[model samples]
Target chain A: MAREKFQTLTEQMFYILLALQEERCGADVMALVAQITQNRVAIGPGTLYNLLEDFLAAGMIVQTKTEGRRRSYTLTQQGRDRLLMEKQRLERMLSDYRHMTAGTEKNQRDTAG
Target chain B: MKRKFEFNLYAPFQYQDLQDHLEKMAGRGWELEKAGYRLFTYRAAPPATVRYAMAFRPEVGWMDQLPTQGQEIYADYCRDAGWELAATWSRFPQVQFYRSRKQYPVPLETDLTSRWRVTAQWMETRFVDPLRGDVAIGCFFAIFLAIVLTIFLAQEEFAPPLFAMCAAADVLMILLVLNQLVVLVDAQRWLQQAKRAAEEGSPGPGGRMSLPWKLTTGLLIAAGAATLAVYVTNATADFGFLAPVRIAGAVLVFYITLFAAFRFRDLLRKRGGSPHWKWIVFTLVATLLALLSVELWDWFTDF
Candidate 1:
C-alpha cells in the first residue's frame, strides 16, 4: 500500500528534522546527521536536496537564509511538532518492548523459583 | 581534439551502466559532450578519474530546454555538492548528468526509496509505456498483413513479388515485436528488484549492460537489412528494376524530413526558443517538403 505523504517519518527524514532544529544549510544537515549518528546515518546530497525541497513545500522547514545557491533552513513549529510526535511513537515502541520482555522474564523467574 | 560517436540506447533505469561507461571513457581521456536520441558524442580530454551521477527532476518535461530556471537551481544544488553538470539528453531534459572528481562517501542518490520512485517513473514514461505502444502497433500491423495475404491467396491474385514483400514485412514486424517484448520484460524485472531493494533499505540492484538490449538493437538492424534484401531480390520484370530504387528514394526523402524536423527543434531549444509553436511549424514544414519532393520525383520520372 502507498504511504500517506510524511505521515510517519523515515529514519533519514527524522534525523533531517532533528538536524534542522538549529539553523543549518543543506550540506550542514547532511554532515550533522552523519556526525550525530556516529556515521550510522548518512544522507546523500541528492536525497538531502530533495528532502529539503519537500520540507519547504510542506511548511515544515523555513529557509532561514540563502547564500547564492546554498540555502539555510530551520524547523517550523509544525516541523517541531512532527519531530516530537515521531520521538514519542518510538519511545512507546521501546516501552512496549520492555513490558513484553518483562512479563516473559517474570514468568521464567517464577517457574525457576 | 579527437571525437567519437557511439550508439547509446540505455534506458533511464539502466543509469548505473551509463554512468560507469562515461566514467570509463573519462578515464581514457574522453569526456561526454552531447547525448541525443540513441547517440552519444565524446571529445578527447586529459585523462582523469571521474564519477558520474544521474538524477531526475520530475518537473522538467519533454519540451523544456536544458537549464530552464528550475533546472539551473537544481544544478546549483549539485554544484554545491561537488558535482558538475556534464550533459543532458536533449529529448529528455529531466535526466541530468553530473560528474565530479571529488570523492564522496555515497552516490548522489542515497535513499533507496527515493531512487526507486524516480527510476520507476522513468521506466514507466520512457521505456515500458513506449514499448508497449510499439508492440501493440506491431500486432495490429501483423494482423492487417495477415488478412491481406489471406485474401490475396483466396482470390488467386498473389504475385511472387507481392508475396515476398509481405513475407519480408512479416519478418520485420515479428522482429520489432520481439525486440519490444525483450526490453519490456527486462524493465519490469528491474523495477521489481528495485522495489524489493527499496523495501529492505538496501542498495539498489543497479542494472548493467543488458544482453537483451544489445540483441534487440541487433535484431532491429537485421530486420532493416532483410527488408532491403527482399526489395532488391523481388525486383521482377513487372515490378521493374526501378521499383527498389523508387522505394529507396521515398524512404530517404521521409527520413531526411524527419531528421530535419528534430534538428530544427534542437536548434530552436538551444536558442531559447519557445516549444509551444515549434511542433506546429515543424509538422507543416516537414509535410510540405515531403509532398514537394514526391511531386518533383514524379515530374522527373515523367520527363
Candidate 2:
C-alpha cells in the first residue's frame, strides 16, 4: 500500500490538532496547548496562525464562528481521523520499543542464571 | 525634556539584524517609535531589556485602518502569548512585536517551513512585484528617450551643447533606473537564499545594499539634476516661450503619472478586482489628465 500523505505529524501539528478537538478561539488554543503540554511544548503565534490557515485550507479544520475580531475553530471529521491515526502510529512505536527492550533483558537474565 | 530621535535603515530581509539592533537599542534606553521603508525611528527611554520579533504579513496594505481579519487574529494570539505589537511597516510587510526579557519569551514562529513561507511572501509582494513594475517603466522611458534624441539630432538648427546636456541627463536617469533594478534583484537573491536556509532550520545571511551601488545611484541623481538645470537654462534662452511650455507639460505629466499610480494602487487594493482592467483605466485617466493640463497651460499662457 502507498504511504499516506500526512502519515507523520510534527510535534507542533499534533498538539495543535489535539487542542482543536474542542471548539476554541485562536488565543484559547495557544493557552490550552501550553497547559496540556505542561509548558514543555510552546507553539508560537506565527507558527500557530500559519498552521491554522493551512489546516483550514486543507479541510482538516472548520472555522465555527467569528465574534468581533476573534475567530473560533473546531476539528473536522477528517482532522479527527488524522489525529487518531497519528496516535495509533505513536502507540505502535512505543509498544515495539517495549517489546525489544523486554526481549533483550530476558536474554541477559537467562545468561546469568 | 523631549526625547531624542534617530533614523536608521534596514533591509527587508535583515529581520535578525533588525531584531538584534532593536534589542540592543532597548538596552541603551531607546525604543522603536515607528518603522518605514529603509527608515526606523527610535525614541530615547530609560534603559531596559526587551526582545523583538518580526512577522511578515503581505496582505496588509499601508492605508488599511483596521487590521485584516487574519492580522487581528494573529495579533490577538501574540498578545495572549505575551508579545505586544510595537510597530508595523506596510512598505516592508513586517510587524515588529516585542516583549520584556524578564518575562518568559515565546517564539513567534516555531516551525521553519512557516517562517520560510512568510519571508517568501514578503519577497514576492514587496520586491518582485515592484521590480517588475519598475522594469516596465524603465523600458518605456528608454524608448521615449531614444525617439526624442533621434528627432533632436535630425533637426537642422538644434543647439549641439544643449542637446548633449539633455541626452546626458536622460542617460543618467536610465542608469539610475537600472541601478535600482540591480539592487532589487540582489535583494531578491538574498531572500531566496534565506528561504532555503529556513527550510534547513538555519539562520540565513543578512541582506544589505552594496555600498558602491548606493554611491553610484546618488552620484547619478546629482549629475542628472545638474544637467537638467543646465539644459533648461540653455533651452529657455534659445527657444524662449516654447521651452517653458514644454518643461511645464513634462512636469505636469510626471506628477500626474505619479498621482495616477498611487490612485490605481489604492483602488485595486480597496476594490479587490482584476488588475489588468485597473491598470488600463489608470493609464487612460492619467493620459487624459496630461492632455487637459497641457491645454490649460496653453490657454493660460495665451491670456
TM-score of each candidate's B chain against the true B chain: 0.77, 0.61
Candidates in order, TM-scores: namely 0.78, 0.66
Off by over 4 Å in 2: A1-7, A65-67, A92-113, B1-8, B37-39, B61-64, B90-104, B139-178, B194-303
DockQ of each candidate, alpha-carbon based: 0.39, 0.43
Q: Evaluate model 2: give its TM-score.
A: 0.66
Q: How far out, in Å, is residue A94 in model 2?
A: 4.4
lDDT per residue (tens digit) for residues B249-284 in model 1? 766766676667667766666655567776667677
Clashing pairs counted in every model: 0, 0
Candidate 2, A1-113: lDDT as tens digits = 32333457767889999999999988888888889889888899989998898789889999999899888899999999999999999999999998889988889999999
User: For candidate 2 chain B, which ten residues in a row score worst on lDDT?
Assistant: B90-99
Query: Share of real interface contacts recovered by each model?
Result: 0.45, 0.78
lDDT of 2 by residue, B1-303 (tens): 335444454555666666888898899988877664445667777888888888777666544433556777788888878888777653443454455464458888887666676777777776677777887787678767856766675673456776677667666766766666666766767777766755554655464456755676777777777777776677677768588667766667666655565555444445644556666776787677777766765663441
Off by over 4 Å in 1: A34-40, A64-70, A90-113, B102-105, B125-135, B146-165, B188-216, B232-256, B270-275, B282-303
DockQ of 2: 0.43
